[model samples]
Target chain A: MQPKSVAVVGAAETTRLGKIPDVSVIGLHADAALNAMKDAGLKPSDIDGVATAGISPVELAHYLGITPTYADGTSVGGCSFMLHVRHAAAAINAGLCKTVLITHGESGRSRVGAGGFGRAPSSLMGQFEMPYGVTSPPTMFTIPVLRYMKTHGVTEEDLATVAVIQREWAARNPRASFKDPITVDDVLNSPMIAWPFRMLMCCLVTDGGGALILTSAERAKDFPQKPVYILGTGESVETPMVSQMEDFNSSKAFRVSGKKAFDEAGIQHADVDHLMIYDAFAHLPLYGLEDLGFVKPGEAKDFIRERNTAIGGKLPMNTNGGGLSYMHSGMYGMYALQESVRQMRGTAAAQVEGAKISVSHGVGGMFAASGTVIFTNEK
Target chain B: MARLLPEPTPETRHFWEGCRDGELRLQRCTDCTHSYFPPRAFCPKCGSRDVEIYAASGKATLYSYVINHRPRPDMGTEPHSIAVVELAEGPRMMTNIVGCPQTPEALILDMPVQVRFDKQTDDISLPLFEPAKG
Candidate 1:
């Protein structure tokens, strides 16, 4: 599909983030979906197509009472919503669906009617990595950072610095789960979950979700909210196991997906007015910067340390505090995408002044999958 | 229940069986000559069905790892390294670094190591590694 052929007419997150122990997983999806629908000035009858990662599109349609010609249930990882937008744009261009609703909801903390992170013993991860005592995101997702740090001459202080910088952005946003500024020493002093990664370096375990509404650019003017044009989008997958990543220093999937989106958008890295690389772990943005060509390999740590990507830097990144200080609902891609949309619409809680371009990137399942979505306020 | 072992399928049964017999086996595509781990029927690179299995040198080097503070139920309270080692033959697989301190100074990246088998059950033997003998 051509860039700007489709646009995001609506975007909203669950009414209450952080801890919603009272709400079930599906209930969270519904709450976000209704809010997005209202933001778009539409109802169930106006939504002819549906997409989701939290649950099956069939189930979302059944619950939302939308009967459509197009339904997408692409679940690679947290970036599933980004892929849904990419696919929805293509589906809309092909006349498969007029308007698509992409939803993501996870009771990450509450676990109310939610599935726990358990791999079946017969599955590949259960068979290979699990038996070795590797468990949880802290154990598996963090497996590659040691080599990355060693090769780049990065100190443990560099990792903690990421959390510190993100909290600076978080302190500005009232919706952020963690608003208090933390020092690198505070981060280093936090409890250790894995070597080179303290508790502060890890993402928050909160219960929340968000949704998006997409339609043709022609119909975008009808929406109540400003349109966030889908300028470029890309998605790809690599090995499911973190151990099998092509390189210990960079994510091959992130490189592939980020390049595809940048190429499709026909924009250089310098054109990105704002950015969001999924910070599930503090080290991820380091990998993202290098792999996404925003910085050279082994230089992202210093780039971050020099405050290049921090608040008031040349590249205003993760202004919503990211998954580190912001609310992380297991799948963090949705929140990252929401922040990008907010930046483009000039409504972010910690808004970047006059921001026009934003790139949102995400990784799923210990670097197993990645997706990138480039949005622009201008058509 | 926490000693999560892989229930080998037909595609990967030989790998588990080789471990049971004190062998570290790897599959290589005869077409592309690319060696890979966690054995499969076809080459991941060239997607060729023509492949062969061979006993690796049982030699490897530490590629990457994380010293997991949270140990598995079967493992004692002490931290252990969940590591990926690059085989001398050119494939990487997940394993534990045994017979060495699971500390940053000791578990250095690129350190030479040799594979050893720990027979877990009648049907399973885990491939573990220790510092290579000089």
Candidate 2:
């Protein structure tokens, strides 16, 4: 059976996501949700269903002042919010809810004093890998980052080039955390966080929240703002154990999710006008670009150095400054979708030219989980 | 740092005991002659319940590795080599390479290595692998 067509009628985000001193976690989520309703020109009464994630969800429902017909708080690494979008579409399409709000918030910067895990990792983590000293997400991701470098002969400078490109794009974005331009030399000289991964390559911890509202395409016409249709969405997961992974060089989940998304949307990579890939680390985009089939294997380094990822290149990627320069909330996938919606409506602060067709991707858990969504102006 | 600790179960008791003794023993299915680690009762290869706990040669070849330069507060120092070693007895193990600095030139893929144990305390000794020159 064909699913009902869903449209993204609202997109709202908090201020630049470094550390917010006074705001509580629920407060941050409430602010984003309230702003989204205003952006859609809809009231809180318009939201009958909700999908939330990242540390706190039920608490947010109580603060929002409405009981949802459907509520979900499934946290699957960092891509949980993007997955929520998929689940929300089904809820809205099935008439389980007239309107759905998806939200996420994290006080990572303040709770952990920035650069801390904030809370204990999952219990399974402590039982399996923690005793050996495999602690924190950066340390986990560094395994593959190092493997990719060794397998491809990719240099630390190659990793630094991604930071440079993203920083160049971030310089133009008003909401970007780091607006100051950084050179490749600056990245190379930065302190090493992990072997082969420097401080520059890692993402900055930020406290923030993002929100998106969805309704059936038929209901979108009544809203004041232009609606961005959810053309197609897909998700995939791989082995959570980094050691048991089939391959360390690239993420299989990206390929699986991207294929399903493109197939459902009836579009190809060549047809995409813009791409918003989640960038928790600099190597993230490099692997994502390759796994998404935008470039050949072991060629993303050359792809970035050739300036194909920048503005006016073959692909305009992470125009919102990306997590590298943008905000690295606990889960960055929501921001990617938010930016795509803004770009499609010609409302982005740093809009990509003629962005009618866009692709937003979210990667989570050390190359273990990935989700992809294709959005187009037309339903 | 907390996630790396091994939690020993009934099937894994013997293997962990071997590590304490500075010996690397693998679970072998006597019926099919299959070997495995992170010890288990049923053979992952042949699903045989009948198995033997025997000492392995402790020799292996480097399958893959990464040198972590960013060590967290609990984990002191950076640039440690975490590796996947293919055992000569036909099973794979996840371990670290010690007694040498972790560098691209030092931690090459397919390099021969041998197991060594670091006694953390009286009852606990961790297994670490290092390059073994013939």
Candidate 3:
């Protein structure tokens, strides 16, 4: 049986990207949620469900004056929203709830107040990973990236295509952190932040918020906005600890998640008109392109170097500038969904012509959890 | 300068005791004799509670490694070699390779290595590994 259609009715975000000292994290979330509702012509009472990541769901619901019938506070890292997208869709399909609001906000770059949302203490994950002094998200990702380069002979310049190409897109995106163009030489010359990696290769940390509203297809038509359909989604866990993974060079999580999502959607890589592979680091997209079947393993570098991922390339990726240029916002996955929705609605400033199909893949917990969602204008 | 940093929990106590007593310990299934690391009480091979801890020859080869140059709070200024070693006893162990420079030229893949100890404090002597002396 085919899946029921879950349409994204509204999407909106805060004005600032890197650092917004004027607004609190909750304030940012509330603003984005209200804007999304306004854009979708939804009232607070219209939202019967709420899902949040890296922030408190109950708190966000409270601020929005929404006593949601359903709420989720899943913390699987950046990809939590991608997982939430699938969960929210299933819930609406099952008639569990309608008009779900998914939101994310963070003051990561500003390091606002040194605390906002804290996970459960009993989690051994922080202990195993943090004490090794692997505090930053990109640091953990670099481990596998380094191993990938070592095994594949992929160079730093090869991985630089992710940042360089995304930066080019950011040049056109007014909200991007970096408006200036950067070249492979600039990436190679950048200071070494991590061995086998340079400063240009890592993603930026910034403060921002993004919110999207999902409703049943039947209800979406009743709303005032165009419906961007959720084509297919898949979520899974490969390994919680970076060390436990058998293959550091390749993300088994991405391989498994992408295969399942593509198969469920009944779509091949060629069918995707655009892509939003998460760029927590430049290597992410490089490896993601390889794992998502866009290119052969160990060939992402050459593909990217050949400019296959540029603005005018075969796949116009991260059209809203991605984490490198757009807003990291703690978890960048939510923005992936936002961008896909915008593109399908033909509302994106950098909208790709005839963009009917797009893929947004999110990874969290040092390649531990992965979720992939395919969005299409056609149901 | 070598001492027991922190012994393994009940889940890995035998592995710790083996290192302390000069033996490379592995969790083995009494039924299949398969060994594993980051030890577990139950045998993964047969899903059996019938398992025993045995001493290995403390030998392994470099399965993979990365020289981490990023500044870390706990590790301080020195670059460290993070290696995943494929043990002769069958399981892979995540450990640091020390007593030599951390570089691709210095650390080669498939190079024979043996376990060593770095005494961090009274209760925590880390089990570090290094190249086996010729």
Number of the top candidate by DockQ?
1
Indicate which candidate wins on TM-score. Answer: 1
Per-residue lDDT tens digits for candidate 2, residues B1-134, read 33234556666678768889989888889898888765778887788899999999999988776566765555576667667777899777667888776787887777899999877656556778889966
Cα lDDT tens digits, model 2, A1-379, are 0322888888999754677978877777887899898989877776888888654456667788767788877777778777887878878777798888888777767763223453333343342345456656666676666567778989888999999999888888888888899999999898876667678888877888889999988999888889888887888998665665667788888889887787888877889988988898888898889988888889999999999889778788998889888888767888888889988999888788778898999987777788887787765
Which scores higher on DockQ, 1 or 3? 1
After TM-score superposition, what is the CA distance of residue A193 in candidate 2 from its true location, in Å?
1.1
Candidate 2 segments exceeding 4 Å error: A1-4, A112-124, B1-4, B9-14, B23-57, B77-79, B86-93
- Clashing residue pairs in all predictions, respectively, total 0, 17, 5
Off by over 4 Å in 3: A113-133, B1-8, B31-34, B44-46
Error of 1 at B127 (Å): 0.4
Better of 1 and 3 by TM-score: 1
Model 2, position B29: C-alpha lDDT score: 90
Per-residue CA lDDT of model 1 for A1-379, tens digit only, reads: 5999999998999999999999999989999999999999999899988998867889888988989889888888888888999999999999998999999899999998897778887778878888898878898899888888889888889999999999999999999999998999999999878887789999999999899999999999888899999999988899999998889899999999999999999999999999999999999999999989999999998999999888889998899999999899989999999999999999998889988899999998899999999999998
Interface DockQ per candidate: 0.80, 0.42, 0.33
In angstroms, give how far residue A204 of model 2 lies from its true place: 1.2
* lDDT scores of the candidates, listed in order: 0.91, 0.79, 0.78
Residue A143 of model 2 has an lDDT of 68
lDDT of 3 by residue, B1-134 (tens): 12113334557556555555566677788888778655677886688899987777778877765566774655777777666677877677667777788887888777889888555554344566789989
Better of 1 and 2 by lDDT: 1
